[model samples]
Target: MNTPSQLLPPPPRPLLLLILDGFGERKERENNAVHLAHTPNLDSLFARYPSTLLGASGPDVGLPTGQIGNSEVGHLTIGAGRVMHTDICRIDQAITNGSFANSPVLQNLLHQAHNVHRELHIFGLVSDGKVHSALEHLFFLIERAASQAVAVVVHAFLDGRDVPPKSALKYIQALENKLEGKGRIGSISGRYYAMDRDHRWQRIHQAYQAIVHGQGMRFPTAIQGIKASYDTGKTDEFVEPFVVGTYQGVQAEGIGFHFNFRPDRARQLTEALAIQPFNRFPRTPLEHPPFPHYACMTTYDASFGLPIVFPKENPTDIFPEVIARHGLQQLRCAETEKYAHVTYFFNGGREKHFEREERILIPSPTGISTYDQQPAMSAPLIADAVIHAIESDRYDFILANFANPDMVGHTGILQAAIAAVESVDQAIGSIVNAAQAKNGAVIITSDHGNCELMLDAETGQPHTAHTLNPVPFLYIPIPTSHPLPPFRTGGKLCDIAPTLLTILGIEQPPIMTGLSLFVSS
Candidate 1:
């Protein structure tokens, strides 16, 4: 380690903090973005100071669920000025134990939301794949809401993006289980909505079908009408439903994998027969037949979409804006529009059940732009936001996420990551140019590392999946009338917040961990 430098006075300037997501690290290949980009501006930032990688641990990153490190932890640490270690699983456990208030970090969040009426709306990965939304996090949030008398509304963004498609109800059920019987905590009361329809009513497997279908014969769910649905057009296909597994090889036992939801529920309701199975199934047979099981049951609104904030996005779809204005009166992660992806957000196609994007591998010469999903480019809108933030006098931090890099990288899109990185570089050049005109101190860094720098474990080739490694942080000089920054920020995730507070002329309190490298020696 370098010698501890002499102590110096902190900079007395407003900081322009920019946290880039899924940036940093690159393989040695000649075609990757980090290796190919003509980034003199980035190189110059490197020459200006001491820097190190931020170990963006997916779990440590404090997502409500999941193993990937995304924005939830990155920004919260930067904003809260400390690492509270509020992992999603821990939050889940706390909810189970009814000890959430004991977690000072969560308590602070809820308390703060209560104080600001600043709606604490959580937008995250809703999956038991546990990518982001954990069963416990939602449970505790409800308990906290009920305790503080804060009205709660959940806008669940489904994650067939990571886990199995039909499994959405599993995580949802876990949340429901906790919320059950205990008044309104985690119940079906608050404005509950889901955004991913592709996973809405996914196909279930044989074993799962067996268990859930067994329950269906006894439950007999309430629906307007019901009818037998099968490919009875062909006489051979008209065989009894139990033979569905034999023909389809799905073990079509129980009220299991039915094609439609209305009939599926009708199959699930064992009791709707006026009384017997509904009443007797509950009391009569604990052992005579298979035990009752739930296939997929969740009470979520058909509405909810990612809140959009670009010219392209329909702002009226923002459910949080509605809740804060009319209901609970608080907000979290609410910003006008700085999302790295779509600039203009709408929820129209949210509920359509579609297959997950099939992961494909492309050799070095291939590119994603040449394949499907030109992947909606929010660049123009994001570029506009970056420029506006640079121009704004009160803006202290501007975070812009360029997703194709890391996202495409997950599909092993090497060339695509490189292109994505180049795009990011261009975005940076524009933002810096704008900042220079306004004389703001610009601080740029990425949350975790992915894309251009994949080291495959099997082939040792640059792999596609996210890797655990240190990512590069490029700090450009803010064109302030003041002198240049002597050194750049250092340490790790813990250090980012302190560095910003230093440049902002704010005193770094003890609660605010991480050392500020911007102070002069």
Candidate 2:
């Protein structure tokens, strides 16, 4: 039996790590967007190089058991090269142990609201999905607030990307049932309106108008609005803003509490909401003063300006400086939506730019309300950027992410998702060709899976969430002079950092829990 070992190889030429966001492998080829996509380049690479599956979900990636892996958890594990508890796990523990219920932040906010005679408005996702805010946690908070005779209102954003598409009504109704006497559902909107990261002001403006100004498409009930959204052919996540009757009647006065832990999906909306007295509607500025009495679940991005009482520690602090100590020049690029994942989460939640590291951001094409309309989202530009950076020989390492398959796959549009995968494949081909020209090795893998399993096995409907499926990891060596060894087995995301460090002739950090995948005979 072969045991896991830490062995370093001599540093070779330049190397690149390409992360394909939301790309996963599936057994059933039918309805598999990746398999359906025309990915000749990826196929050729898989055949030519050693490839293996990578575990990216649940405990394998440091998430709680049974919890599906997300971009945040996956990237953090890959960057830290260790198994660390994810944000969801932290939240889960807090709620389970009554820490969240009795948290000083919650108590102070509620006390401040009660003393000021202000209504406490809670805004967050209404799903039980762990990626976003959990309904149970929200309910527990509401229950505790109501116990103190504090009137509370909720602005629930529908989440179709993390849950089943078009299932917003089910969650909305369930929430309403729970809040029948304790609280009220003030507004209903899609995550798209409340969670654009690329500074999309229009969506934020619409959500602001609905929640604060009480001016938008008014719906008698959340279910009715969700039904209308389906009739209008909009996915649950992209549905237009709809204000519940109670919200229009009662102003968005008093202390507002935002409950999203992960900020990437909701960074822009949070930024817009921080602006006090938002009157310009669609013309809100990107940067503004923080909203009064507003607090977020975590302070992942301190610059966003929301007062956070429970901030998670950055895992990079525990990570050894392997790449930086080696004096490797690293260049990274990705579209706006995933720029943070490649930099922030991929650096184990570090915000500070590392020395000798360069990052390039390509603005995601705007004007399209939904990603499915423009399935090929900026992959070509990112690919071009990576190719230029690789061939420039200015950097010893290149890291890039193609955000198409993940962004488009969230729409659950079968053909569009396939096209997105194809676009990524073409980008990979360009990168591979560029690496060949520069005599550089390339590591291709994914953060998690979303496009591979296109349908729900039980319901036979389109499933728009990340899966527990394993991701593909392929490594192509430079020089192409010697035959590569057989691929190892049971690779996980954490193994990536150690493997890359080993290839660069750096000592494997003891903090890394994953073993290197490179095995020699």
lDDT of the candidates, in the order given: 0.39, 0.79
Residue 6 alpha-carbon offset, candidate 2, angstroms: 9.9
Report the lDDT tens digits of candidate 2 across residue range 174-261. Answer: 8888787778888888888887666767777788778776788888888888898899888778888889865763333347788877
What lDDT score is found at residue 367 in candidate 2? 84
In terms of lDDT, model 1 sits at 0.39
lDDT per residue as tens, model 1, 160-279: 333432234455455445545432211110001122112211111111222223221111210100112112321111111121111111111111101111111222221211122333
The window of 10 residues in a row where model 1 has the poorest summed lDDT is: 185-194
Error at 331, model 2, angstroms: 0.7
Residue 151 lDDT (model 2):
80
Give the RMSD in angstroms, all C-alphas superposed, for model 1: 16.3
